[model samples]
Target: MKTITKYIKISALALVATFGSCSKILEEQPRSIYEPGFFETERGIMGGLTSMYAHLRWIYGQAYWYNTLLTGTDEVTYAQQADQNFLVMDLSGRALMNAENSRADAIWGICFSNINTANGIIEFAQQVDGVTEAHIGEARFFRAFDYFLLAQTFGGVPLDLGAGELTFNTSTTRSSVRNTVPEVYTKAIFPDLLHAAEHLPETGRVVGGVTKTLARLYLAKAYLTYGWWLENPNNIPTYPAADRIDPDGHDAQWYFQQAYNVAVQGIENPGPFRLQQTYYDVNLATNDRNNELLLYADHTETSEFYNGGSLTWGNGGAPDNFAGWMLTWNYTEIRSSSSSSAWSAVSSVQREAAQALGRPWVRMAPTIGALSNTFADKTNDSRYDGTFTTVYRGNWNKAGIQGPLYNANYLPVNPGDAILTFLNEEPTQAISYGAPFNSNVGAGVLPGRADFVISPSGVSRRIYPGLWKLGPYRTDSGSGLGEPNAGSTRPFTAAKFSELYLVAAEAAVKGASTRAGFTARDLVNVIRARAGVWRWDNNGNTERIEDNSAAMIASTPAEITIEYILAERSREYFGEGYRWHDLVRTQKWTQLASSYTICGPNIGDRTPIVFQRNIENFHYLRPIPLGQLDAMEGDRGIYQNPGYD
Candidate 1:
């Protein structure tokens, strides 16, 4: 894209200090103009490296780019109040995804800009005084980091933006050429990460900076993804029409074994990073930036300047952490009675800056399969409770509505009482529909219950569970509802330590030889064992301490297939922007996510409708952005992916 040419001329810095670290390492002033000779100094190299972390906010937690990761997958679909930005991505024959409207353009622009800044640092930092190889390794990790994302999304990307191969470009050029998939992995991604792993320190320089463990995680992941591309088990198509042959003489089995070896190395020598004691503690907003998280796109509730967005109101754009608002239905519409005798309704549930309730956009909703089939073991597994806000309690007293309000079956509800609940299973008792309460949404009433409820089969687009992990949390919200319109201040998690175990397991499933204690089932059970422990019951709003690890391990099948690993990955990392990449890497998008069931996008609609996606073999690779194709001096047909052209 032309943004690469423009970014080289200007330097932008949005340095943030959310975690406790050395102040000099995390703070820097912004620069307007970046000359070609500026990189020869130590200050210029530090500023450029900090901007690489800041640019991740442009893609990770932004709402539109979040839609590109999830909407077509089996995890989520478009909701009642969805706009065209979310609808076209469902891929259910409503509208086709073309180069213009696909939000993958956000990744194209942001990654290329960061890659150019990294190239400048690596080329000029060696001549500067008192610069170590560890400082240069940080830049190398970010360069490979962005290229791996680009290679996975758009199959073959341009290694040379404007200048020669892997060089920093100073002048503008219009001509571009696409590199092959093997060239990107072997020539750019693998080499940079290998240098980073060898030269980096064990611990990070800053609070969340790059280190040897972080480099090994990405290197192992790239090796595993490249091995699947070489195998081509499903015969999915690639862009630029290159044959699936490694430039090096290694086969797919060699890459898989390398992936397993590196992942095991990272797991053996984890520096200050380990799995959390329970699944609930891993995602709790108060426990953010914990030891389990390796990398994140951080934001602060303390400062609007360092947070890169407003602290009061977010406009749902880049540098704003508003991905949580997309799946949140409007819980403010739920009502209770002012008088128990008549039908005088009072709005019971108000939006608050709590972990369970946040501002609602109603743009995306979870499917029936995600609720019922994926999380079937709700009794023993705590991930379903930790991942979703199933119970929405009343806060009408905090919103200045006193007196005990009446709810379903004419029962009383106070401030902390349950207002609405997304039930775990379909109740055997008869459900009473429409009454003194406003059943405008698809909620029904049970006998002598104070809360309105909707079973798993009754979940609709207008009313469903909110994503509890990504919801809003702030210490400034005292006894009142604090800034509900503001973007979330929590750091969006990018990579974690627990993924090292899953990566080794996936590689072992692909014909890599296993060690004694690190078999495929043994590695997966490490994650499943943690899912059994519970410190808090999220839906019940009570403290529940239990250990069901033996039951969880007993339920595992004797033989673990790739399909079983995919299911466990979903239960562990659902709604964290990992679904599409997982499906694409295994070439199981068409086999697993071809059809899904969800209710229609209306208030009172509850009938499960099965929708079919027109997924073709040519759809394995996403099209190049229209802006990139428009700026280059070549034939557009040759520049784009096959089916989109």
Candidate 2:
């Protein structure tokens, strides 16, 4: 169901507060009350489940979460913002992330809070007669999901398991249950997911609910990520204590095989899932319940869509606007003199194409590596056009002019002069740019140039691709329902079923698990075909994806290696916020991103000045949040992840 009906009042338990209040009294409850009595009945169990699901909205809805994931990866960099908090060291490659980093703290807090919430629900569900395996299974799935994020992002964290490990009261002093990476995998993430997979409904459900298929998807991904750690124990600084290591053989290959098996099972199942015709279709609000989505953090504009979809305060599970929407919008927009006219630029498009023309926060921009290298197949790939924008029409309204153009300068603003014009086709050096540029294109003249060179430097006329994926799609300020600024309220995707294809392809290449009896080529080709990359297929291995590093040529399925797979993943999922984890898990962050110049004058001409970041081996994990360190009563402060202050 898109909206889970509430049957019982949600508990604001003491896990959040050291001696937090227990569930409310049943008789006094508003329609329903929260308490042990509620847990004992089916209605109460379902309501509690609804509350647990609400935790997801909290975890994924924050803007900072997206910022943490996207910045400093191989794909993105920040725009110059005088008020920006991130440093150059962060977004370039080496994220000088410290325990005090607010983003880290937010991530830690959100995950653990939800983790404890899930634990409480699971604990109560076990003793209830009416709460069947599904109720417990749902709770178990979340326990593992939150832990999986914790394990991947922070290495090891306090293993709460409803243990009051994170309680915030004064009298209830307890130590952190933080354990090692492998322990977290075995005791926390993997087992919970396994239980969830075994008990969750095998039949289809909406993206908002946990299903057997979704459980398996996460299990496979967790195993896939853990497999990387198993192979190179030394590479990760958060290695488990000597005792935590298996004495008998659990190797990377074992994890891979496990992941492969689960993935294959999910794929082979007669589930309601298949690739959508276009990448855009996967995320449109209209097709939200489509089969291709395995799981997602749910959000809705109306209460009808979700039980409390619009109830912000009383209902714990009301959907929220992602905090990162503003950040993502700012970073990915084109910098233009006429940028204020963005709305005017879109005045002619269909109403659905409500053009807000983002505020040029330019807090992040596509790395030159992302823009030029990833989409090497300029001719066939549909993703290129779908993901980015090239042409920028003028918004004469904001500019207070017919069109944005000038001869040499505005009032002859030399040196600082800028021009705004469209190029019907790319220009050769031979084309002349007449002054006071007009739409008239002379035979050998560039269409929109007005003495393009004499008045402006190349910078003035340059318009980079706006990351259209996050661009506002609706602008009906007509509703008075937070319209206009309401664009950010659009739901952001946290995961996609399409990633399963990439997972299977990568697994096949590593020989860690069954190739699903399909070659990496076949799996990748399915996505590529959907992406409109009409290249070689499983039929004959006719052509291989281009990496842009090499000349255009055909490579066979045999050439489908991890490097190509990673490159392909970049093409398919760059702005969706997977780059850092993608590179880190694949052990490619340092090799691919460390040397990137995030800010300052173009060391080689691509990077625009702002903040910068780099990657180091220790960077694989973000520092444990400082608040967590301060709260720990023991010398447990010694447990801080290395390389952070």
Q: What would the TM-scores of all predictions be? A: 0.97, 0.75
Q: Residue-wise lDDT of candidate 2 within 43-75, one digit each (tens)?
A: 555555555555555555454566667666766
Name the best candidate (by lDDT): 1
Query: What does candidate 1's lDDT look like per residue over 1-645, in tens digits?
Result: 465676555545434223322443465445555555867877677777777788788877988888888888889888889888888788888788889888888788778877888888888989988567988898899999999999999998888978877888887877778898999999889999999999988888877788899999999999999999999998888877789999998899999999999999999999889999999999999999899998888899988877878999999987999999999999888888887778678888898988898889999999989989999999999999999999989898888888998888888889889988898999989887875556656688998789999989878878889999999899998899898999999899989999999999999999899999999899999999999998889889899999988889889887888988889989999899998899999998888888998888777787888989988887677778888888777688988998887
In model 2, how large is the Cα lDDT of residue 464? 38
In order, what lDDT does every prediction score?
0.86, 0.53
Pick the TM-score winner: 1
As for candidate 1, its clashing pairs are none
**Model 2, position 273: C-alpha lDDT score:** 63
Cα shift from native, residue 228, model 2 (Å): 0.7
